[model samples]
Target chain A: MLSTLQDEKQDPRVKRTRSLILNAFMEILPEKGFQSVSVQDITEKAGINRATFYAHFPDKYALLDHSISQMFRQEIEKRMLDACHYSDENLKTLIVTVCEFVSNANSHCKPSSLQFESLVEAQVKNQLQGLLQVWLEQDDSDVDAKTAATAASWAIYGLVLQWSHDKNKKKPSAEKFADQVLPLIAVNLRLAQPA
Target chain B: MLSTLQDEKQDPRVKRTRSLILNAFMEILPEKGFQSVSVQDITEKAGINRATFYAHFPDKYALLDHSISQMFRQEIEKRMLDACHYSDENLKTLIVTVCEFVSNANSHCKPSSLQFESLVEAQVKNQLQGLLQVWLEQDDSDVDAKTAATAASWAIYGLVLQWSHDKNKKKPSAEKFADQVLPLIAVNLRLAQPA
Candidate 1:
């Protein structure tokens, strides 16, 4: 569904303008806080006029919401597909995938500002929830399967959040952590369906 | 450590002032992004002079940072202690504790913006890293325990983050999820070493 948003026939100018604004937004996040940047700043940075920017995005913050949603949805889709094959041994794969997505979702390597952080995170959270929902439905009725899937999705997202801004801690591979957690989840849930 | 900080209290007036400012900060986060709330807004809400506000916190953002740090530390401590009793069928008492913490930390009854979607997640991440560093001090030759710890901590943190935020997602009991993760963590990293 996320990938389906694109239309090859849409106005070329609209796509170009939107891409330019997103690039400008990403560049500015590392250098300045989101609240500090203005619509004028974005238009100027993107080499587009105020009207051109507005036509594509209502305001600078709108651009951020759009970019974050689209990018997160895309990344989650990809990760979920790749995650289809994950088992206990190579679990770090999923963590790495999610971490890269979160890290990249931030404007540059910076933490998302208070301005759009919640909205963006909400979208990301929804995407993860959607993915988990689908993963849970794959197997028949086991109440605990749904719980495990939910745990898997949130656990990965939370870990990425920690890794992004945590200063005092050393980093870990997300995949391995996921592997470690799955069995614990499985045991506690006592799933009727065999994995 | 957090308990220590809360105990060696300063003037009641100082405590009252800080509480006022932090409450005001949470009040405005939903309406205005964290990046937008100014010191003046806080002062006006707290019914304090700008000079008095500055006497406590350097600025609006600094107050947010401080508040977030304190909040993250507080939750980390609570979760660790609450989860310590990983009894029979308790399913990683740690995981359950964090889920319970998230579920309870912000509620409609109390409505804590300190636990707002974007704020303290980073603090949780960093705090987990610190915890892992302490927990993974075991003498393992195969993997660098620090990296392993970071990975393990992040994974658990991520799990809880998702669990906390998923309003609609079916969540397992804190005991169930923790039971799932804690043992796997112990096994994978050999965290079973005697502490």
Candidate 2:
């Protein structure tokens, strides 16, 4: 399924419109920024009418949302689940998966289609908030799981945020990052350990 | 110091103006929204002159920033930091500190200081950006630690955004919340551990 996306991205028409809209998005975003992106502007740039653009996407925000959520969902969710089991090996694998996932996603989707600033809270938080809720539910009834989940979920979110912000030369290896960050997560899981 | 501060909050004149500003802030927030708050409005309600108000704060945004950051730095950081060795505990504490700080800051600052809609990347990313750069410069060079820090920081920032947009009960039980969140940090730290 993932491999199929690379093939799909090769379509010239898809590439053209998506690129045009994205270019327009970038131009508008840093200027008037996210709040100002208009459907007409995007359509005009792509040389398509409002109707044509609407057929492709419901609205400017939705198109931008889809571009980001679609690109990274598979990788992020996979990391969340892969990190579910408690073992050193599992942990190491999860770290690489996540850091690499973030790195790859940044390389592929960024400067367009995946600018984090433009994300609306409810839209972006849906999956992460849900993931945290489930994780916090295990062996926990005392604390507000949602809040805990929110904190934990966000830490990973922070990790990714931190990863993407660096203006590195050679680029930081995601594997080493996984190593540095993984230890921070281990202490919280002590509560969930088998009694 | 804490007792003196508490006493000051109880003084009649201070209490009245403070309450007035806080109340006005809440009412204006949902209606005119965050960025729209004005000096005249705040002064009118508080029954204070602009000069007097300025004595307390440089501007409305500064007041809001101080309010939120004050609540967070005092309450959340005290709990999350172990002030100990450079191990998993240190990182978890740091992560939890960040998540909780953001969570608390977002709660108070949203309608007041945290006008994400109005802020540019320069302001939002500036101080934190500098701090992350310092933390990432080390043998840990393999990781774009600064970027990772920013990403993680923003994730917490993002979570707070989600929380602000949702309906949740507000109570200042820092201990309860911190205990709840510690595990998720543990998990992430564990996952990020090096081989």
Candidate 3:
């Protein structure tokens, strides 16, 4: 699934084919949603045959997984978060990024279903855990990096999800919200002294 | 869904019927797994009519949700953690409770699918957040109770889940694991002094 992120360095034809499928999928997702958007719809929109579509993706769920992962990775890279270590500043930026990503996803996908939301949550959290694990391992924290990262990733995703769903017209902006919760999340990564 | 927990204080007949349905569902869940266990299977197992089952729960998913919520609440109540204010000791016990509950759920259910795991996750996390929010609110912390609880609940659930799935022979006991990560989780609720 992560390979999809590096597809740009793959064979040109494969890259172009995948791009077509992904672009078609993004276009149809808002119209039909993840659950209802059929592979045939993507094929038709991409101007590719069923065989070609299948060659690129096993099915629409895999396509959604790939698409979500790529999109989230771009968000992380855009802020250069993928290259940074654990810090309060970086963590705050990461939280804001997740908040905006989830908000965009909630609005972009019309009438998003629970299943679709869960899929997005799973994909985004998985990547968050991986990225956080890398960042924590580069630091001197004595806690289990994998476990800490897992906890932090889930916390970030869950908080951002709640923030996105807040119906209050006075809801804080993503940056402001991130600043408020940054300490709670940062402690997960920064706690415990080097043994 | 939480109302199911208070059914004990409701009419006796309602309590009896829910107990019967929940027990039958638990019995069939191990044998047939959540997805394959139909309402018919549960009804037959409980020796109750379809109408009786319907009168209790709208569908199996609701049954699953109610069952999980009740079970998790019982775990918290059993430890008397639900009645306590925020403290490191209480937090450690809560983390241990979650670890054991998740471990038990993973082992009790047969052929647990991703969907089943996710449903359990959602149900357990909901109850955890509610419980933690109450605990945090009773203390003098200035952090938003809802946001702090949301992040703590997800972190605890996510960490315990990782511990449960650890296939290594040296996986720490739930209590030991909880002790190790208590500070990481405690800070979420304890930080941000009262105004």
| Top candidate, metric TM-score | 3
Go through the candidates in order and give each one's C-alpha lDDT.
0.57, 0.50, 0.83
Per residue, candidate 1 scores C-alpha lDDT tens digits across A27-141 of 7767766767888888888899888777777676567777778777666565555357424433455456566776665646354465566566556656665655564565455
The per-model DockQ list reads: 0.14, 0.26, 0.53
Real contacts recovered, all predictions: 0.13, 0.49, 0.82
Model 3 lDDT per residue over A48-162, tens place = 8888988877767778877787888889998999988878888888899999899999899988976678778989999999999998889865777887788889999988998
lDDT of 3 at A50: 83
Give lDDT for model 2.
0.50
Rank order (by DockQ, best first): 3, 2, 1
Instruction: Give per-residue lDDT, candidate 3, residue B72.
Output: 85
lDDT per residue (tens digit) for residues B1-195 in model 2: 111134533667765666666556545545554566687877776667767777666677665554444444454336533223334445445444554555543454445432433242223333334434444443254554444444434433443344444555663343443344444433332233222
Instruction: Give the candidate order by descending lDDT.
Output: 3, 1, 2
lDDT of 2 by residue, A1-195 (tens): 222235543767766666666666545554444445578776776667677676567666677666556545666665566247335555456556546655654454435332344353333345555654665566455545555445544555556545556676754677666666655543332333211
Candidate 1 versus truth, CA RMSD in Å, comes to: 6.9
Instruction: Report interface Cα RMSD per prediction.
Output: 7.4, 6.0, 2.5
Name the candidate, 1 or 2, with the larger lDDT value.
1
Query: Which candidate number maximizes DockQ?
Result: 3
Error of 3 at B103 (Å): 0.6
